[model samples]
Target: MARKASTRRRPRSGSSYRRVKKRSCYFCDSKISYVDYKDITLLRRYISDARAKIRGRRSTGNCQRHQNAVARAVKNAREMALLPYTNQ
Candidate 1:
């Protein structure tokens, strides 16, 4: 019988990581007219359990413009105490 080749290759500690794919802004593409900070349902997905901030495109798959909008919304929510600034 032929021996099978090794299937696993160990990763180098200093090796560069693979890049994540970008995602378009749902609101922008959908052409939504509003992003209400008081909309808890809309904001819930972006906020974590401890109320930590959501990641940008690099992590959350949001496009640049959409990410900016999300940031703005998050900030507004924070100011209104609708969203927590930090995990608590």
Candidate 2:
């Protein structure tokens, strides 16, 4: 009598990175709200560390129009000392 071969499942190798859901822009999802330069707390979240630069649309998940608004707001806040021009 011939013996049958065993059936075994193989495990995956290498990276185990998980796919995350696409994030919506805070300003858009919340509502058609305006970006206020005086809102230091809100603006802080959009600024990058080390250089204190405004985050790009890709990372912020913002549309082009909103990104421009955010940039303008951040710049205004920086001029008013509400935010630092650069991280130091």
Which has the greatest TM-score?
A: 2
Query: lDDT per residue, candidate 2, 1-88, as tens digits?
Result: 9988878866655678555566688888889679989988888889999899888877888888888999999998888988998777
How displaced is residue 18 in candidate 1, in Å? Answer: 11
Clash count of each predicted structure: 0, 0
> Candidate 1 lDDT, tens digit per residue, 1-88?
9999989997655548565457666777788667778887787677667648676566656666777777788889989998888876
The numbered model that scores best in lDDT is 2
Candidate 1 wrong stretches, greater than 4 Å: 1-22
lDDT of each: 0.74, 0.85
Model 2 off-target regions past 4 Å? 1-20
